[model samples]
Target: MYIIQKLINRFFVKNKLGIFSFTFFIVIFSSVVMQILEPKTFPRWFDALWYVMTTVTTVGYGDFYPVTVAGRMYAIFIFLVGIGIAGLAIGKLVEAMGAHRKRKEEGRLTFKGKNHFVIIGWSEKAKYAINEITETHPNLEVVLIDRLPVTPITHQNVHYIQGDPSIESTLIQANIEEAQSVLVFSDDSIHDSALADGKTLLIVTSVERLTPHIHSTVEIKREEHIKNFRHAKVDEFVLSHETVSRMAVRSAFSKGITGIYTQLLSHKEGENLFEVQKKAEWRTYKDAFDGLLEQGATLIADGNDLSINKKLNEAIPEDARLYIICSKDVYEALA
Candidate 1:
């Protein structure tokens, strides 16, 4: 009796798996004992099992009962141990679920997904960028990295990680290697432009070191600092202050110019810009241009070379990434 008590204590008190295993064993053993001791009362093994389950669960349907002295004594023993152990198992399950949620909120989990966009930094601009991405591709996943105590935004496509993004481990946590692209935003809390750009440059350097070929876009507070990031192999840089100043100046010189920039930049409203694949049969810029124009879409640029009119007669290159401006319906049809 002493040895069995010690064994039960070691298994049931210390280990949750052991507790569950012992509970299952006790229930099955109790059912079989009841069937054997009261073959006249409990005619089948299933009937004994049903009675044991109902008693342990405290359901007590009162449809089955023991008619012999030995069966009644066994029932009393099972009633004490089985119900308590079952309750313990249920409590452990709830605790495990809560721990999982806490770990997710604290950003301690690793993302194992691929081809997702990774955004570094937590700011208003980051929020807008994620919202735009989610709105466009509702099913696509976007992983966000920041140092906040908890995730800022909760969406089906958005995942948040709390860590210093410049560190290789944090980037690995975000799964940056398999990511489609990365967007590094300037830290808004820093007051000095140089400091902000410097931090952003460090983050970009870490990104390039880990994934050399991945496309990276960065936000620069000053235009002069753009040269510093060239070695980091950043694919694009959005001059946050300079772009806004230029847009303000353009809006001042021309009426409703801001609206044009807004329409071009945002895809949620108006005829937005979209990238289209150049068809094989379209030999020249003119052929591609005319084909798209007939579909109510205008081919404005072949990549960054927006002067399509000058190059209309030139043969389209095989690697051309043609961009067009058209309504969503027209772009969908062409796509």
Candidate 2:
């Protein structure tokens, strides 16, 4: 026991690889020495290895035992030192696994997933967005970037990166160049609308500089601040304040309007907006509208153009993007 403690204190200070390498050397040496001492007991190298492993682990299945005096002496030597080496190797392996998990939870590891959604900032709104995205597409991955020391949320499909979103290195760590899209949310902690929008603009500028082809959606507190974001070439702007104000006004004037908006925006148990591929047979807007209507789906728009009813005779362009509103099962049936 005393010798075992001393061996641990002296050599266990080495890193994981060192300890494991030494353990492997000791195991090989024991197998070789055992075979040389007692060829009758361990005729093959594999037999010697099995005997050495069983003895060191204390399993001691006595199928093979040394008959000669010299072989027993070497076996005693193995019993004393080999057990401690085996324990040290196992301890180091467990320690390495635990350290790796800690680094991942601290958001100190780089994300390697491609074609994923990268959401910047941590807030209630960001949490809701994460939930909505996961519910809509369970297979897609989402990476969240923020300055918090530790990750705020934990999910199988979501990865967290702790850093300033405006830094190029931080964006690189999140694999922004290969990401499908990026959503930059104004910091909820900043009370000033101009300052919040300014922070969002900085993040968007950094993202666009690193990934010119990536689609970027940004949220701004004030509607007038969108003009400043235009130079950054942001793909979409979400006006937070104006949208809420309009929703509140509509709800006040009309009954049950909020529920309609929620159904259209969410993946919940109601009708929702979905995009479908343009068919080759639909030569005109009228054909698409009539075909989708017969299939129990309302053709709402072609891309952002909602005047399809007035332009029913208009030719459907080659790049036309179609959108529809339908129940979940109805959409699935049509799909």
Candidate 3:
């Protein structure tokens, strides 16, 4: 048994397509040999082929059998070789599938998609962002690039590539050029805020260098690293410490503000921020605001500038996009 296993392994290693091709050849050869030896039993080529298949698979029905001595001797040879070849073919196919799965889990597989979200880094914040996006936009495709050995988040729409996010090759594997936006996260495992921010800046710079057109949001642990990211032309920056500190202070001063913010950010409950393109007939901010209100939405901003109550009289640009606070159902209803 050991000798046979070793020989099969050696044969597969020497010839990349050996197992499958050899199995196919054995099936054909056995069929032909059976037709020649059992001419009386199976006069037709199709009947001989059927007999070979059933016998090799160990599903022999009593109807088909080798009546002559020469045919019986050939049948013994066919059973040993044919069954071994079929087993080897099945084992090889299973091994290939397992290898492919391992490569995917290890982030070695290439991603192919457009308008997908590319998340650079693996941390608690990154994991939360992935889950939130997948849950909120179930159809949106997300590719995660990190230096971890395996993917931390498991979702059907999420593809993971395990490598340094700062590396251009890794971003290419994630298909950065086809991505609509990227989110660069700081390494939370790194205790030094400066070092973590430095790593994040490298990833942001790499992303910008590869695809300058794609929008990117970067997370900065220290305020000092903001300038570095700005130089990289990052679309937006999230200061974790600053935001948390302010939220904590605000929560202390006014109770329920934090809970309100959480509810607004969550996709499952309350209304969240959404952006919609301005219509041609909407001449002013007030017109767009009223239109959205009719659809159960409240216009909060015009592009990056907050509209709220100040820009009511301002002329809405034809190409302007309006940010509104609304639920997913409400936003889709307007669509």
Winner of 1 and 3 under TM-score: 1
Candidate 2: misplaced stretches above 4 Å? 1-12, 32-47, 59-68
TM-scores of the models, in the order given:
0.88, 0.90, 0.86
Q: How accurate locally is residue 24 in candidate 3, as Cα lDDT from 0 to 100?
A: 84
Query: What's the candidate order when arranged by decreasing TM-score?
Result: 2, 1, 3
lDDT of candidate 1 over 1-335, digit per residue (tens):
99998887788776879878888898899999999999988899999999999999889999999988999998889788889987877777788789988888888889999999999999999999999999888888999999999999988778889999999999999999999999999999999999999999999999999999899999999988888898778999999989999999989999898988888889877989999998987999999999998999999998789899998999998999999999988988987
- lDDT by residue (64-157, candidate 2, tens digit) is 9898999999999988899988987888888889988887788889999999999999999999999999999999999999999888999999
lDDT of the candidates, in the order given: 0.91, 0.91, 0.86
Q: Candidate 1 — what's its lDDT?
A: 0.91
Candidate maximizing TM-score? 2
Candidate 3 residue lDDT tens string, 1-335: 99997886788644548878988888888889888988989889888888888877778886778898988998889888888777777777888899999999999999988999999888889889998998878899999988788888778999999988888888899999999999988888899998888888888888999999999999999887788888889989999989999999999999989987886778877778888877877888889889988888999887778745997888987778788888888888876
Hey, what RMSD does candidate 1 come out at?
3.1
| Residues forming the 10-long window of minimal summed lDDT in candidate 2 | 8-17
Q: Every model's Cα RMSD, please?
A: 3.1, 3.1, 3.3
Candidate 2 residue pairs in backbone clash: none
